[model samples]
Target: MFQDKGALISLPAADIAKVRVPGSIFPAQELLALELREDLKAAVRLIKDICEDHGVDSLVVARPEMFTNGPTTAWLHNRIGGIEDHICISDGRTVRVVPGMTNHAFFMRLGVEKNFERFVKLQKRCPELIRGLASQINSAFTFPADASIPTVILQPAEGLMNLDPAFLPFCLVRHSVQATFDQIALSGKIDLTENFSRCSRLIYVPLSEIALQSEGFCRYIAREIAAAFFDPTVGVILALPTAETAESDMKAGIETLVEALRGIPGGIPSVASHRIVLASQECPESFLFQGSRRVELVLHNSLDAWLHPPEYYGRFDHIVVAASRATDTRELYVEYIDHLLGRRPEFYWLEHLALHPNDTGLIAAW
Candidate 1:
């Protein structure tokens, strides 16, 4: 995770039962609510239980380009360390070990439009599939109704492939599938060989631009739309960095984000979220009082500004916010929440789904 222009610290080994690394997960969108380290461990335990109950050979894992080089990757690959049986694609083979993770370089694999499109085309040919698998390893996934997809990932060349516009449809779709792969599966093939390509900019929808009046289940898009789609509500956590360096970087983060998310309908504009940075910062509990005001807030948790709480906090009951392994040292996280819940669950609830665009072949450096 790049915070204030640098890397976060990796923590020592934890006693937790399991640690799940989602492919290309954005903290602002998918963190657990305030809770203890035990809570996170418990979630992982359930995943393990279900896998074992079903006589599963292994639980599929995935990561995308977005999460590749960030703080989360460092933590999973190096910091707390991986489980002995954890299967991560490494150096052309599936390695079921944790200690040597750093050697292969870490990544959250994704099943994006391009990857899937490519995989299907080659499914009929055994030799081509084997050749491609030798160079690039992959696994299958499915998701729930209006839920995000799940995926299994391995190592990539660069830490990650950063999309210039920031909003990556391929990355998004891959995330949705990875998140829900355990629950749902599509019925037919998505053939986009002619209209779109992984190398292309955007995936073309088969239908014309039909104005969507009703809310569909897409969290990332819905998040931006929260401002216009429903009544956009946001929560902001303002604090000054204890260190001079971090303070400057955090200020830039605010400015950059405000600038990037300028004119989208249902989006939480900058004027709404205030900027409050000071020399003295308070504890997470002290900031909790302001929770009811906005849907989400972003905070700085560098060594200079640390959050000393028993666990991570989230925006609504549906979401979870936890520190990335990177935070073990810096100890921090950030988010954008949605306020209106039960009142209008459709508009307010963030189901954490993704939109997989058409994919390209063997990308992000195998």
Candidate 2:
């Protein structure tokens, strides 16, 4: 029932002091003249007259600290407005504001039962739960024989070109959830490719040229891995980028691609068939499983693992099983990796399925 332009224009305190007169701004004459404007209505009329005379748009008053007396306290408790109207007068012309935290606490105290019931409704209606609902609705998901876990690679494509590609995955997760909430329900298909593809950084070079640079090559691999993850129709594809690209450009592409897949609400089971690959060269042989890469970084602090994963493992059971089985937390996982095999082996794959519950759920019951 309360509606306006919904924009607040703030005038500085200095400007307010220059224009306002203490008590004369109120509609004392009009309130006395009009019989109908009594009690709470009289305060509303006073606020309107002040807005008209003093050009006072909106005023946000912070509460004075405990055991302190100030002009603000007197102005607030002087009964110029109604206790029911939050000790403020509002007739669309002006709003006498109070500290939001104080207002919230006061209202919560007055309507505890109503507020509690509304909180329960909020939990049930949370938009993030749409992901869970989407998960429940789409039950058709299966795993490949080797049980390689599905992964989504996200990269910056267009508008997201400015953002670090590595961050795009988390952004995709958040944005897709938001989109689901906006629509009030999950759709059969969620597309976010166009929005992510916009970027200022792009380059053109031959595939062979890019392969010469290891960093650029690794980045290209990240992009290919991201693209392959989202193409539900194809389990894997080995195609060289016709043009050479910067590591950042390739990363940007991967960021957007992965974000699109990650944003899919309820989860896209089709991604399960795809195994992530970031090899320098595309092996000519067509195969589902050739090998996977495991990256290990040694950091003194646990902060890096949370903020920036030492190695971003895209749910590879082969890699995760060994890591998860060895440690309870990510910090421990890093430590376990550090302690393993003083002499690093040519192939990092391990044979143990130590069988974590979440891992077991991912696999088909034998």
TM-score versus the correct structure, for each prediction = 0.23, 0.16
Candidate 1, 263-352: lDDT as tens digits? 223433222211111112322333333323323322111111111111223322222221112222121112111111111111222121
Could you give candidate 2's per-residue lDDT for residues 1-366 as a string of tens digits? 001111111211222333333332233233333322122222333333334454433222322122134665455445333221222221112222333211211011101122223323433454232221111100111223232222111111111111111111111233444442233223223222322233221111112221212232233333434453455322222222212112324343333333333433333332212132222222221121223422222111101111112222222222211211212234433333333322222221121243421222112210
| Per-model root-mean-square deviation over C-alphas | 21.0, 24.5
Segments of candidate 1 deviating more than 4 angstroms: 1-248, 266-283, 289-316, 320-366
Global lDDT of each candidate: 0.23, 0.25
lDDT comparing candidate 2 with the true structure: 0.25
Runs off by more than 4 Å, candidate 2: 1-57, 64-74, 79-102, 105-366
Highest TM-score among the candidates is held by which one?
Answer: 1
